[model samples]
Target: TFLDAVSRARPEIGDYPFTTIHPNVGVVQTKDGRSFILADLPGLIEGASTGKGLGHQFLKHIERCRVILHVIDMGSSEGRDPLEDYEIINNELKDYQMRLLERPQIVVANKMDLDNAKENLERFKKKYPDVEVFETTTIIHEGLDPVLRKAADLLATTPTFPIMDDEGTESSVLYTFEEKRPEIEVTQVEDHVWQVTGTKIERVFNINKLNTEEDFYLFADRMRYMGIDAALREAGCMDGDTVQLCGFEFEFIEN
Candidate 1:
């Protein structure tokens, strides 16, 4: 049983160059009221064992995970053979952590609704007979509930560990709210309009709908206070230029 089966997990906060250390960890809460962290480590590549790509960083994050959800793009739109892609990732993980090779990994076949996905799935199964795969179409929202339930069940039975481990030292699980300072990268796209992106800004926009003047003001104030105004000025954004959020666009002006 896997407790959390997500296609893509990014850092809570990010800078110009993303790194192995995450700003904030992802958490999944089950019906029984238990919560488990879904840590997003760097992805494993073909030569990750030999310090290729971010393989070492990616393997370290899985060390604390009870189960591994190997998410694969089954559509083959990325222009690589699906089975080879899976094998490359699997080999990298094996090279980085031999113990991880023994851990239960659920093959999450994503992009199932694509035109060529079924053929790739068939090929994948033929090559890896022992793997258990779950199909999902993220865009259409199909085959998601069952995956969630399976993830919860797996987490319930999995053992836990400290995020930062000490050699041969036993530790216990505990929740700590050590506040993480947010890292946002703001680029000036035009005069008075700053192109802003980061986990903090996105989450704030997701939870706050600017239907009212007050909401819009709150959002504006946040941007100004976060030094987005300075970034916009540096980018030469004019007062009337258009700026955008999640999906909504707004005109730039001094409040």
Candidate 2:
């Protein structure tokens, strides 16, 4: 019902480019002159934490949100158990990021107009008694005002949290040493031709524009320092052999 809420708040929402596949953001102004921006994120499925089915993308957006509105379909119209759906979605959220569970959540029990919706909602409440739930049927736009008001009230009290924390202390100097790995791979493609390819080597080659001979020699010296020269020699690369790095080729000269 997030889309419904947005439509109600902004009647011109139809003219805007709105899609459910990506996050849809809209601003709502209450009768009391309070404004809140609501984000309608993509539906999360089971196994989202371990990069399952766009779960990471959906969960990443929730990290910045101070309040979460978990809209559940109370009516089992899609052949899904409302209680099971709630558990699955919550489990995914908790698994993806435990911190997400720490945020204040308002349960939106949608499709209340359905026959079995009220019964399902009661069961859901009995299971999660501490949770705050609001009922609404988006089709007729019923019971949305209370939900919006409650969300605004909760937002007032909720504080923003950082996505990540700094590792170093105020006075401490933290030196991180990334394990030195072979940046260039020397492979004898032919008798006198060697092919060099690796992520780091390609990035270095592109970033440093080696225009002059001094620059080229400096780049070659860097390659030597990185043990690329030694690697090529060990791989049976001879003097005058063509050493191909990325798209650039140079004749090898042994020191």
Against the true structure, candidate 2 reaches a TM-score of 0.59
Q: Tens digit of lDDT per residue, candidate 1, span 1-255?
A: 121244333432222111122213566654555555665443444565764323454466577677776778899764557888788878776776546766567678888888999999998888878877889876676676555667777776766644554566576896869456355656655444445556677666567544344555676667777776666666676665655443233456644
Best by lDDT: 2
Tell me the spans in candidate 2 whose CA falls farther than 4 Å from its real position.
7-20, 165-255
> Which candidate leads in TM-score?
2
lDDT of each: 0.60, 0.71
RMSD of each: 12.2, 17.6
lDDT of 2 by residue, 142-250 (tens): 8888888888898999889778634442756769796765656778876676777676776676665443445555676677677777888899988767665543345
**How does residue 129 of candidate 2 score in lDDT?**
91
